[model samples]
Target: MAFCTSTDINCEPCLYNSISVPGKGWCLSCEEGLCQSCVDSHKRRLATKNHKIIEKCHHVASIRHLMSQTCKNHNTILDRYCPFHDDPVCSLCILEKHTNCKGILSLDNVAKNVASSSSLFSLQQNIANLVKNLSQLNKVRTRSSKQLQSDKIVKYTSVRAMRKRLDKHLDTLEEKLLQELSSKAGTCETEINNSLSEIESKTKAAYAVQSNITLLKTMATDVQLFLAIRDIDTSVTTETNWLREFANQHNTDELNLDLNTKPMEDLLRTKSLGSVRIDRIPNHVPINHLNMKEAQIPREAMCNGIDQIQLYQKIHIQYHNEKLVEILFGCIISSNGDIILADGPSKKFTVFNEGGNHIKDIHLPGTPSDLTEISQGRIAVTYGNSKKMEIAEIKDYHYKTVISVRTVASCWGISCDNGQMAVKLLTERINLYDTNGLRIQQIKVEESCPHYINDITIAHRHIYYSYPYQNSVFCLGLDGTLIWKYESDFLQHPRGITTDGYGNVYVVGRHSKNLIVISKDGQNGRELLKCNITPWSVHFDKHYNKLLVRDSEGATVYKVAFRL
Candidate 1:
């Protein structure tokens, strides 16, 4: 839980393990190993590019030995050593201690052959084993602590709940006993839960040992590993002892409710004739935890800023006196900042340069309802009435279709993240598709939205869909669990939704006629800009901090700039 610096974690892989290649430098803020490949990527991100990185030299590995020079006992020079006890001693200890021990030697002599020692590998394995054990124990203790808090809250709530029930059951003896039973058992539960707090002290010790050993294994060379192994083992052993003490002291007590008859000697007492007395039986059972959260999530490889983006750029397909009723239903900006759009009335997909200049317009087979940037400059567009979709690309200023497929039903709204795409159909169901354009799964929009699923977008590995009538946006995980829905202050008729590279979502509110920026976690929302007319679409250029918004009344695109 303690944040370690870049020197603690191994530099990120430069394609392969950095251990095999020399580190170009270290990103101190990210605590990541760096290579030339990520240099531009890191500098592009709004949150991370400003991070300070130190370029490392070839001799950096040699300096790993410096990690072992500190003496734990004296915080001084570790010069003397005792072979019998296998412990390092400082100069103050050479005169005052280890004088009577036989076969005493210098600290360096004991460590000279450590890299070649048979125990080096064994010690490394031991350290790894301890890491696994301590990590699991730490997680279990942490969960237990949270569960304990929940149970405490439940107990407090039950007391008030039982008090009300007692009033209702005043005439019934059985109900009176039930209320007394809960009250007595709640007290016993608190004591047992309070006692479990002792595990925290031990878990922290194990965590410290695991961190130190893991850091040594990663940042230290083989010889450094050998020299630090004994001291690390001592610290690990102390943590192990703490864990043992926790196991010995911690217990899960079971509450028992029994009927206790009131004494006949107290005839004037108004209390219930029979009462429930609670007792606890301490059970020495410990909890074992399991099930990993998930494998991992990959993020955007590069970051970009939008300082160069200009305003008042528009893309309109007008053939003198032709009425283009529904123009831009949805739009997307590719990772390279090229713009893509679903031109509904024109029945085509439009591509624009990062500067908003019209490039190539690839006419679709039918009315293109919604568009999502698939990858790079490639895009997937859905047909409103054709019940079909196709993957297209804009390369070298030319429009080319990659593939076309007919779906079971017409899907209007589409979005893609990672390799997955979600298509929002007219029936208010989202069809999930893999990279091959094959429908993998379908998710239903069950939230209370009086309107249609206007636009679907994916970000942070989750799906975000807008409903103008609901005046809100709902965020759901890829598995279809609704994480949170925002319908608060800044939102009016939130329509199109898209996430920036940093996980912040930008949405257009048709009713409020403003651009809303909701945080990635869905905890807050703020109106970033107010449009003169209701904005039909809001899309973020993945390569830059620029946001592209098109008003409903015109073909004009508003290029706005803001920090993540």
Candidate 2:
């Protein structure tokens, strides 16, 4: 649609001529413009007779931008397009470089409908989405930068405030210690001063007694002298005893203050008041970027029913030389595409890789009835005959119990999503717990009282379960409101249930020996596959779009595709 205004719009003259002429047609194969006489002569030649030449002015205008449309090696116009190599080639170029390429067509035909193709539109939309995502991320990063600046100031102020508080606390301790030292020193000084005053009074009384005794010896009779002497002796004896007791109890030892410096030394050894750690949290900004697989699907196909099931791998779960068992109660796929099966008879979990090779076997404390992965390498398991569920961590091909949740009745099936876990109990109740195994609530099922719900799964804010005796599948909201109950003859005694990205429910019928996929509305059901072995459990790995159907002895993985 673009008009030609460049200098190349004029006619390319004959190869041997020096004159230019107005173009009457464009030779796509020759990669040159043709005047009226040149157009007649071009079609007369045998080599150029079959070449595509556009005679319209608008068509020439559109193709004027297809500059330098010639093979570099052959110096020939690139007229043919090799579909296999995805390149335009001349006759000589195709013979040399793309001889084996198939579906080679004329370049003009190949590019005629490109502008109206869905691929072009999709590419444009992808570019737009990319720009929008970049803008969002840029805004988030800019805001985060500003937040970092503000947080830096706030953190600095907080640190300074803590230092000041520490200084004040130390000052208080120092003041209390100094005050105690001063009080003790003052008491010592007062005691010494009181002792000095008492000594001085005693000395003065002794001098008075000596003067009286001297006067009596010179001028008084024997009776007066004797009475005075006896009174002085009594006073002297009491003073001597008091002085002896004081000397025994007290000594002039040095009043040195010894401070216990251990606490101060420990304080000085501290490196910092506290640590400042930077933790990388999940990004709050949603970057809606589609990967290759998601981007290739047409928008309308996203909500369509599953088109077909392609078998990916078939795995025989029995351990080497082990006798056949009848109780493989639970099956799940780890994040690494490793299949983990809970063998009730063996009281252990068996692991196998995507290639159907046996990896390892992990022993469980109790018989596991159902298991679900709560996070990467972590699973919550419900025991069939026990009143507790064990949370275990899978590491280095081994598993260890992390925690346990106690139930009022025996635990059966378990499913976990987001941070919440829904565990099916032997009674008609589902015990809800957090990831840490703390029971938060109990959802009582009034529909299946005598026969409890067999398997349970939670997805997309909805709780799904199977009632084997009732021969039905029930979907309920998180608050236990019934959404739909699916009853079908094909789903006889459904034991295990799971969901896919399209919200389609996949369940296994133990008695029917089939795997059936129900619609999201629970109004329709289709048996995806039937097996010779009775299917005990079913699990769908949404990450890889693979289906896992398991029995006591074997399991199969299928790659699922959806169609509009």
Candidate 3:
């Protein structure tokens, strides 16, 4: 009779046995009794991946005994076991040797723990998640490293490109300059060679003459020599004169060389020296935009001894708006020490003393706008509304209008010379008049510039006018031709003009809030003072060597020192 296989031999084989089991499958190798579940576990388990499973026949009696025999190391009958700690290890061996180790345990104990412990599954899941996280982090690091390297390469390429362009430009400039120098050197060498060749030819001719003379002396004893000597006396005088003429020509040539060639060598040396020096061109400096400071007067300093004005001073004048008549347009100081201010809208001209005291009021019939001091204690005033000019005389606190004319256009700038007056008309033409108000000449300007001519002064036989609208100043010759023009970025609404003894031009601008000093050649300019509020007029007093600045807004005057 055939007995059924043991269910504990393998779960799958036991399932097909006469006795029933939970898992059921047919194992190909374990044909008689081995189970498919056991075969799969044998292939997957670490120590069992290479293990061979064989069929165990339930009819074989010896196989059952072999499976039950105890392991030599553990003294426990073979049962389900842990391969890591030796098969069939007893409970006592497990406690002593395996203790709390994870990989050492009885198969029955492992099975029971796997079923009961949820924490074991959780640990396996966490291990898998950690591996995935590490892979992602590695990928990110590699990508960022590559990007950084690429950016470095790009930046290096750009820098190299710029360097190459600069080198090319420098090379081109150097080559061009060197070629020019070489050409000049060649010309100088040719001239020197020609001069030396002429000197060498003269020396050779002199040696030839001496040789002929020596030969004649050696043959003097012979009869032929005696005849030759008689002929030589006659030729010797003519030869001497020819030699003197040659000497004179050589001296003249040498003098020319000293005068011309020596200067060329000196010039070349100077140029060579200049080439090594740095060449820098001056640039125009722009005006700084800033507010003006408040005007103040020093009462205690006013009583100081009457001293000559210095190069720079801080003298202030007392001002009362109500006590002083407002001259809105322009002002000028006459040779007789009288101050004339144009009261434009009021149609009157106001006169004041040097002490800021109002002296007289000249009621102008046609809006007295601008004023300039001419000769013979006379003043030239412009009428804006009537578009005419008026010549007047100032004497004993009164003004007598000598002449008036409607032929001239609206006058903005007025200047005077010995006995003549130059007026800048609104029609962009400058009209010249004699002391008797007779029109002498008229000159039309090119390019109608948008400038409100504020003040005019005569200097160096030219008429200088301030153009506040364009922030510039202009100079015209006595014949009404443009001599020079200067554009100042720093001058704002320049209304007043004055010239110092050294030819420097000074202008006062109301909105610019500063006094501007320009060089005579109009090359350099600078802001001298930033303390005047709405400076409307400026005067350079030759006798006192002082700069008088008048401010219409503050109704005050400031005394500044003038220096060359």
Q: How does each model score on TM-score?
A: 0.43, 0.56, 0.41
RMSD of each: 23.9, 36.7, 47.2
Clashing residue pairs, backbone N/CA/C < 3 A, model 1 = 11-33, 12-33, 44-303
Question: Measured by TM-score, how close is model 1 to the native structure?
Answer: 0.43
Flag clash pairs in model 2: none
Off by over 4 Å in 1: 1-328, 395-400, 448-453, 553-564
After TM-score superposition, the amount by which residue 187's alpha carbon in candidate 2 deviates from its true location, in angstroms, is: 58
lDDT per model, in order?
A: 0.60, 0.64, 0.51
TM-score of 2: 0.56
Tens digit of per-residue lDDT, candidate 2, span 1-564:
112334344467664487677787877556578888889989999988997676653344432433345466887766776544435678998778888765577766544433332323343343344344434444443444454445545655554454455555455444444455445445544544555455455545544444444443443323223222333444444544454454344422222333332233454455333334332233444333222222122334445554433233445554421442444387888888899877776778888898888888898787788999999988899887778898889888777989977788888888988788998888878888999999888887877754444788988888899888978999988888899999998778888899986688988888888888888888778888887877777888877677788775677776665322
Q: State how far residue 560 of model 2 sits from its true place (Å).
A: 1.3
lDDT of 3: 0.51
Using lDDT, rank the candidates from best to worst: 2, 1, 3
Model 3: per-residue Cα lDDT over 1-564, one tens digit each: 011234353364455556554333322222223445556665687865653344343222212321233445777533333333223355666666656533443344332322122222222232233333323333333343354345435533543443354434344433444444444434434443454454354434334333333443332222222222223333333333433453344221211110011232353333221121111222222211111110011211111212211233434444334323334366666667666666666666677776767778877667766777776477778876477887887777567888887754667667676677777776777778887789898877663564354477776677788776677788778887787787776788777788765467888876887788777766667777785456777777543345767675433344443111
TM-score computed on alpha carbons, candidate 3: 0.41
Answer with 2 or 3, whichever has the higher TM-score: 2
Better of 1 and 2 by lDDT: 2
